[model samples]
Target: MKTYYKDFLIRDWQPGDRNPAAETISTVLAEYSIIFEPRGADIDVLEIETYYQETGGEFWVIEQEGKVVGTSGYYPVKRGEKSVEIRKMYLLPDVRGNGLGRYLLKELENAIANRGFQEIWIETASVLKEAVNLYERSGYQPTTGIETKRCDRIYIKKI
Candidate 1:
């Protein structure tokens, strides 16, 4: 599915999107002093179909000027009943502070809920203050469990 937001376009991962999407995510992480672990935590960004689609999930990319600048995706997890964990949500420096992050998140929630998911979980680092605030403002409650080495906070929202 494709969604349009002003001059930006939100769409599913395509054949050539993997590298650019991974670079966008890596660049965003670097801005926060977080290392991008492509073969480790970020392997999904490299193998979208294997890790996301094969597990009954999806990965999306945001594009502007025909170039990818942001990425977000989710996959099924065993933490909660019919739950999916939101992962790899990163916005490039160019797209920051334009309300695009919130828009993408809302779209993710709607899509996940439409898929009959009962709960949505997010794991992120406190260094990303904007992300933490976004989750709180979006009604995601604080929770325990830091599965990723770079992440220190987890939040859950029931749909």
Candidate 2:
């Protein structure tokens, strides 16, 4: 509901938080899938856990009064490009429209840019108008390349 920015206390997601994060992700995915299918709709919990376990990717959680309201993460891409694919960006329903989404987007961009990534890419269903707008406003423009089987808007921002 309420939103504000503080120092982003982020680190690699631990094994203990994997299930909770997966639970949270499942809820969001189910909720959103009603309108637009997520890119990786067939992903299993074990696969999700393994991604966190193996990639050593950054999974950031936003805390307000010590409660996790939102999360964002990135995974490495192929060589030469040296890109990071932003994934699993979700904010609770009650936390929407209060500026937290924009805040989180900025945090992710800053984190990725600092890690020496050349650009960031994201895929979301076109039905998610808010997400498309957020990406555009955050300097991401529509891109030609999208690898999803489903129809999803693709956006990229140069770091």
Candidate 3:
């Protein structure tokens, strides 16, 4: 299924979207001076459905003028668990501050909620201030005890 938001088209990830999605992520990471590591292996967006679909998770891409410009998804933190981790949400610089992030987030949240997920967890780096702000504004609260060297900030929301 595809959703239209102004000139942007949001839809499930397709086979050809992987490269553009990876480029979008790479550009964002480089812009923020962050290095891509094994933890960021999901940059290979084409394989997202392979890893997430069996677990009732999904990967979405946003296109403008037929080019992939944004990506987001969620996956089970553990097999058969009610909790899922939001992953790989990135938008091109030109599209920021226009409410697309919130839109994509709501879509993902609703999809997971319908699939019986009870909680959403997200981890982001301090450098990505806008992302942290977006999550906080969307009702995610800071949670302690979870640690990751790649991402220092962790937030969770119970749905």
Backbone collisions counted per model: 0, 0, 0
Q: TM-score, each model?
A: 0.98, 0.77, 0.90
lDDT minimum window of 10 residues, candidate 1:
143-152
Give lDDT: candidate 2, residue 145.
74
Query: What is the Å distance of residue 66 in model 2 from its true position?
Result: 4.6
Best by TM-score: 1
Superposition error at 34 for model 2 (Å): 4.2
RMSD after Cα superposition, model 3: 2.1
Residues 46-71 of candidate 3: C-alpha lDDT, one tens digit per residue: 56656766666888889999988888
lDDT of 1 by residue, 70-105 (tens): 999999999988999999999898788989999999
Q: What is the C-alpha RMSD of each candidate to the true structure, in Å?
A: 0.7, 4.3, 2.1
Order candidates by lDDT, high to low: 1, 3, 2
TM-score of 2: 0.77
Q: Give lDDT per model, in order.
A: 0.92, 0.65, 0.82
Q: Model 2: how far is 121 from its true place, Å?
A: 0.6
For model 2, the run of ten residues with the poorest summed lDDT: 35-44
Quality of model 1 by C-alpha lDDT: 0.92
